[model samples]
Target: MKVKEVTFSYNQTVEQLKAVSLAVEEGKITTIIGPNGCGKSTLLELMSGHYTPKKGQILLDGKAIQQHSPKELAKRLAVVHQKNDVPFDINVERLVAYGRMPYKRFLHSPSEEDEKWIDWALSITNLQTKRKKKVEELSGGERQRVWIAMALAQKTPILFLDEPTTYLDLYYQFELLELIKKLNREYNMTIVMVLHDMNQAVRYSDWMIVMKNGQVIARGVPEDVITGERIEEIYGVKAIVDYREDSGVYVVPIGPCQRDE
Candidate 1:
């Protein structure tokens, strides 16, 4: 997917994104990270066709994103938003079955093919055992996985996640990131996500896009794009990157930068 010269405004007054452009490398995990209110989630929404850009265009499969109908786009890609709400109480299996809606006609029952995808989604997400349990009965991490299972059942090549680690404890955070990595490595899924944790972004991402003030400041591989100088500039923090053979790279933030008054 490619976003070219895109600009967006929520109310036609202040712009959230300004002439931003970037190409997502296929079959790789691309992460967008920045401080709060930097248009990270907004940009993801636009790319996933949730919002329209006031200027420029988003292209998926070499065609304008808007050119594809909603069901058509859903078949090509899936989105797991920052927040999800199921109006009524439901079990995990039933919830995941919703991902098949794109392929099912109204009032139609699940075909044999739908059952296969649904079962695969549950198995991949490790929710098969919990399939019969109520969504409310699961832990936060399990609930997050349930949502992911729903997305997986869509069986799309591209998956977009917006701040998926938010509201989770540290353990669940890494667990989810690892699952995302597995998806990219094993399934060759083209994954795009908005992340707030710098170190996690570096660890899990194949490419990085750093945004600030509604514009992309830097985008490249983690080694090339994430640096002490750039960290200070983008996040107003003084930090160093520690590299180890066992653990890979980590960003250590010592303190906030001292700005001239």
Candidate 2:
């Protein structure tokens, strides 16, 4: 997906994004990182058809994003939002079945092809054991996995994840990141996500886009774009940069604290 000089604003006052231009490459993980309310979510929304750009275009597979119908868009891009209002009694399989809505007709049930895709999605998420369970009874991490399963069921080449690990324990957070990496490596998925943890972003992202005040300050591979200087510049916090020799990724903001006088 390529965003050609897109500009978006909310309420016509705050320039949420200022002429931002970006390209989300295929078969790679691209992460957007910034402080609170810095338009990371808005940028995703714009790409997902929630908001239209004032002066530019978002291109997917050489076609403009806005040109696709909503159903067409659903088949092309799958999204896992930060929060969702799920029905308490819905079984996992039924819920994932909803991801195939883009392909359904009136009074239609799951086709053989849809069932195959759903089964594959459950296997990928390792949620086949919980496929018959109700979503409300599951843990937070489990529910997030269910959400991802639904996205996978969509069977799109592009996936958009908005803070998929929010409010999770350390173990679950690490697990989800690993799962995402596995999906990308094995499936050739084009993944785009927003993450608050800079260190985690560096670990998971193949390419990183650092945004502040609604503009991109840096964009490149993790090692090239994520730096102590860039973190302090974008996030206004003192940080220590640690380079892992094994992985060659720089870990930043050892602590989110300021120097004492």
Candidate 3:
């Protein structure tokens, strides 16, 4: 997907995205990282067609994204928001089966094909055992996996996640990230996510887009874009950018620093 000079506002006066532009490299994991309220989630929403840009356009495969129907878009792109609230108590399997709605016909039950995808999604997310359990009964990490399983069942080529690690402890956080990396490597899926963890972004992402205020400050490979200076610039914190022989770039923030007014 390509965004060109995109600008968006929420209340007509508070612009959330200002002339932002970036191209998501296909078949790779690209992460957007910045301080809170830096428009990271807004950018992801725009790309997923949740919000139309006030200016500029978004293109999928060189075609305008707005031109596609809702179902058409769902077939090509699946999005998992920061929070998912199911109005009623829904089991994991039923929740995952919802992802196949785009391909299902009205009044028709899930076909064998839909079941196959749903089963695969549950297996990949390790929620197969919890398939019959209520989503609300699961723990935070398990619920997050259920949401991901639903998205996986969509069988879209592109997936968007907004702060997917929120509310999870350190161990579950790593587990989810590993699952994401596995999905990308195995299926060649194009993944875009908004992440607040700088080190996690650098470690798992192939490309990083750093935004502040309403604009993109920098975007490139993690090794090139994530630096001590850049982290301090964007996050108003002191940090060290380190590299290990086996692992890639990692960041350590020491403390906060004064930002230019």
Candidate 1: RMSD over Cα atoms? 0.9
Clashing pairs in 1: none
CA lDDT of every candidate: 0.93, 0.89, 0.93
CA RMSD of each candidate after superposition: 0.9, 1.9, 1.1
TM-score of decoy 1: 0.98
Question: Which lDDT tens digits does candidate 2 get at residues 42-103?
Answer: 99999888789987898887888888999999999999999998897899999998998998
Worst 10 residues of 3 by lDDT: 83-92
Give the Cα-based TM-score of candidate 3 against the true structure: 0.98
Q: Write the per-residue lDDT of candidate 3 for residues 176-260, one digit (tens) a residue.
A: 9999999999999999999989888988999999999999999999999998999888888899889998887888889999766
What are the runs in model 2 whose C-alpha is more than 4 Å off?
252-261
Error of 1 at 54 (Å): 0.5
How many backbone clashes does every candidate have?
A: 0, 0, 0
What does the lDDT come to for candidate 1? 0.93
Q: Against the hidden reference, what TM-scores do the models get?
A: 0.98, 0.95, 0.98
